[model samples]
Target: MAAQRTIDVRAVGHVAERIYIHDSYVVTFGPDATSTNLWTLSNDGRRLDHLKILRTLEEPGGIAPIVDTERKLVAITGRSSGPPELHISDISSGDLVRTLMLYGSLDDVRMPYSSRLGHALVSTRVVDELPRVLVVDVAGNGWIAGVAYIPPDLRTSTDDRPDPQFGAEHITDDGDIICSYVAPPLPDGVDHFTLIRWNGTPNENTLPAVRADLSISLVDGDAVSVSCCLPFCDDALLVSACEAVQDAIDTAYSRWSVLRAIGLRALDTLWTAEPVWGVIRRLHHAVDAGVVLATGTQNAREDGGKNIPVSFIAAFDDKTGALRRLERVNHIAQGVSVRLCAATSDTVIVIFANGDMSMASLDDFLAHGLARDVDTHKVATTQLWKDDGKKVVHAALASTSVIVATQTNLVVASW
Candidate 1:
């Protein structure tokens, strides 16, 4: 582990809300609290470069930004008051290449695994409407290549009652869009949750009927539901339920089966087991590091006038789903959450809501979980700012460094 070097970005004036680290450049989004701008910072954090600034429209999602390095293109969602717009920019020159206006509000945007395809998966929903998934070609004049609509019957009602919403899971490397919807039980005793895949074709502007690709069933009555069904590697679908993480596989042609299911444990102060209340926030696959999972849980017990919620980052073997490395941090204050976790070549970088950043060595963590001894598994810890008022919203990691973004500034620390 290298000695910690901190670069305080609060002096930069603009609020840096999102951070992305590509090959040699670090990209950040948001200027002040009200303005939407993108800036590129050097890896060492010594230099700040202005990339692009949006003066006309508000980026309601802080650009929900996605960057394709090979295509040199970046896409971000604009404000949602009127007809929504998606902005595409050139990463190299920071020029606004094009803007895509849609009939609905853009909820999510994702680039395919292969940059050669030059298309992105977008999820949008009109006012009081169900969600629709569209395939957009960024290189081909930003045309709508294909579209898929969620079934009306399965869509959540717009009423005030608590309803299950729809979300896009993942876009496969081959450009297929995987979507999942959670539905509450009807008058009868059955729920209508489904997982669907929208096959991508070259056809343009055609809305294809939604097809349910996989049928999921809750194993126990206590198992509330399943969500975040995403494609894992090249074969399996990684899914998270209220209490478990499952790997769904295709045993036969188009026949899916749960190969392995692992139950999650709630964070307990004492050694006694508690009811599971944690939810899996995100899952990611690293180069040679297998699968990395992030989970969040609110502590139910009141301890010393504080209810401490915690975030856990664990690594599992890709094939066996066995635990490799685990680390958990307690958030002592409210509104403090884990913004992002990135797995680099040998280190796991975690950025929290209070602007505290930490790194753990992969080898050391696998051998000794969360060792407190600074000489063993821990790398370096740095406090970017004193005020927890400005939250750390996003983070990304390169092979050698990590960049974190707060509502007011961007911090770059080298490992």
Candidate 2:
């Protein structure tokens, strides 16, 4: 471990988007009280040599910044009084390259790491209008390639839609967009999940799409709610769902029958308790390691909602999904959200919203599980930074270093 380092971008607001880390520069988006700006800093978290104050009409924190190092391009989503707009700029010069006026109320946008192909998946919904996914080219040409209209019946009326509600999950190397769509609750029917593959082509009507239903029945006539679904690999999907009456978080592989389903609360007695079963907030797969990591607030109400403890669990298993090790990383305060959990070849890094971070050896977890709970700290160490009202909004892992973006500054920590 090394001494934590920080860089100050004075008066810059909290990071509301993803931070982009390239060879030697860290690019981020944020705003002050009056306007938004695109910032670039050295990779060591020491200097802010490049800054571009955006237009006065641009909305702050509207879209996460996406950088394409291969093309020296940066894409940002913002809005004025009209629909959302996508801005493309030169990463080195911070000069505006192009602006594409996306004509709907934007919900979300996903950009591929490399923009050499000039494509992005955009989701938007207007009042009394159908939600749609738009495939746009954010290069200087600004071409609208295709649109996928979300089935009207799939829109949930219960509350704010769970994410991936008609959003792109993954884009293949061959220009195919893999996305997820969840049908809303029906009169007497259970909600279903659909995984669609769209060929990136211009279409006046619905985009040429092929879809597969990923829903499964554990028992007859049981209603299940899909919490989230993401592309697991080139041919498989990872889905999380909860039965109508079951509180445990059930995670399964969409295409692999050999991989058995695992519950987040299955191995821990603390999580098996009544209310804690519903506490699993998010699930992420370490694709390189064939393991799953889940994070959430446990026993939230028991702590009177002020300082609840958030828990992290790493589940390691084989290709057949037999549980090998279920390790619960020590819980942290409720105010601290796990902003990001990323892994390298051998280390797993977890970043917290309150500026706390920890790293655990992936090899150790696979070898020991929780066999030596007391020695867990030896393999994993937690460090806390002084709270300054600036929360860490996003993080990225570059080799062994972790790049973190807070509301006012950028930090780089080495494991």
Candidate 3:
């Protein structure tokens, strides 16, 4: 194996919003942050610099910066305090010039994601109008969801044609809002997914806004995947999930004493949809070289608070539903364990509370080596994320000053 490279974090402050891949170093900025602070560094853990993301009113870190090579634009996937938002930067001048946002006021919230093609997609929870249905948009500002108001005088038929055939006021300049993509909302509560798209002109060779087709018809309940993200964008949209279903504890008893994981998978209806299940919690970063997933599973579980079991670690292939690797963590603090996916490789790094970040190749886990543990403790502050009944978790890569922001001081990262 190659010698372990060192990534000097030059700086770590308030909170991070997004990390933008720049020509020199990866530029990180904050969304709800106060000042426009940007952290810059090279991709190979070499050169680094820090600059002002925008002028003033730095929105902190609520967006991710993507390099639009074709458009020569440094596009930012940003969010705001009130409704969700998406901002694009004028790479020519390093300024946030364009914008996008969710239109309707759904009971819950919506999250923005992107395809490999640079086209962004967002999903939100819908209430009043429909239950168990998600509102969606692909073209962003070029779309809208509304009903054309028809006057009584225009009705000539006896029953006054109920809804207009072309009633759906859609595909404006905002974006294309597509419905009926996923199977349907689960019955009880088990995370399910769907796919939708916009044809630019509804009929043209523009581009296929293909979405991940997640179906939940078989599972008659509500279930969601939160805080987990796909490693990268392959032909198929593959995602990884980590649910520490139990809390950590320290006990003293010796009957040939050995602690184990006690995970409790819950099944509820009401609370399921309220929190929006199966949402991606975070995206540490994408790795293009690997197509596998690594996991650290807990044996013991939780009922109220989230759980973490320092017991086991495993790996799997996203293309084929096959277990690639698995290992048991020598119980450190009883029921507490976690695996952090590396940003460049398919390496699932382990972090313990004792503050040691170690890495083990998932490739070796498939051959023979046990889930080599990396004892690492995240240096971050715990903060409460206020989500609007939407089964959504913000993957905002909070940073100091790489791009301009609308607000600042987003929730601090716990891990």
User: Considering every candidate listed, which one attains the maximal lDDT?
Assistant: 1
lDDT of 1 by residue, 1-415 (tens): 3433343443355556555555665555555435555566566544556666644346545434667777777776676567867777787666778988766765543333336677666667666655666677766675787766656455567565344445565555566565556554443323334565555542333333344422233343211344334345554466554432233221111111221222111111111111223444455566476544434343433333444556666666666666666566555422346676556657666676677776666766566654354554332345667785877667776666666666656665664
Displacement of the residue 253 alpha carbon in candidate 2, Å: 20
What is the alpha-carbon lDDT for the whole of candidate 2? 0.52
Better of 2 and 3 by TM-score: 2
Q: What are the per-residue Cα lDDT tens digits for candidate 2 across 218-281?
A: 4422344434433444445444544342332232211111112322112111111111232344
lDDT of 3 by residue, 1-415 (tens): 4434332322233344444444443445544454444444444433344544553343533334445544545544343566545455554466766565553332222233233234443333323222122223332344322222212222223232221111111121234433222222223233443323343423222333543333233222332223233323322223332221122132110001111111111111111111111222333222453334333233333343343344344444433334454454544442333323232244444443322334444454456544332564322211122322311112222222111111232222211
- The best candidate by TM-score is 1
lDDT of the structure predicted as candidate 1: 0.54
Going through the candidates in order, what is the number of backbone clashes in each?
Answer: 1, 2, 83
Clashes in predicted model 2: 2
* Per-residue lDDT of 270 in model 2: 15
